[model samples]
Target: MKSRHVIFPSLMIIFGALSLYFISQFAEPRFQDASVDAKFFS
Candidate 1:
């Protein structure tokens, strides 16, 4: 039961990192009128 608590959050962090890396690969450049870059939001 104690291990379950640690495992879940660790898995969440790993998955979140993986997803961010995957999404960043497809990020586009900033728009002409936008102040921030597209990757910043991605």
Candidate 2:
């Protein structure tokens, strides 16, 4: 029962970190523009 206190927060922190890392990596495009040509040329 006591372990649950530590384990739950640990899992939450790990999950949050992984989620943030992945979001940062894949969420933002290198090219801010939406059009293909603009992005390709810019």
The candidate that achieves the highest TM-score relative to the unseen native structure: 2
Error of 2 at 6 (Å): 0.4
lDDT of 2 at 20: 93
Instruction: Give candidate 1's whole-model lDDT.
Output: 0.74
Instruction: Compute each candidate's TM-score over C-alphas.
Output: 0.63, 0.67
How many steric overlaps does candidate 2 have? 0
Off by over 4 Å in 1: 29-42
lDDT digits (tens) for residues 1-42 of candidate 2 = 999999999999999999999967764564454567446655
Q: Would you give me the overall lDDT of model 2?
A: 0.78
For model 1, residues 12-42, the per-residue Cα lDDT tens digits are: 9999999999766655433434657644554
**lDDT of every model, 2 decimals:** 0.74, 0.78
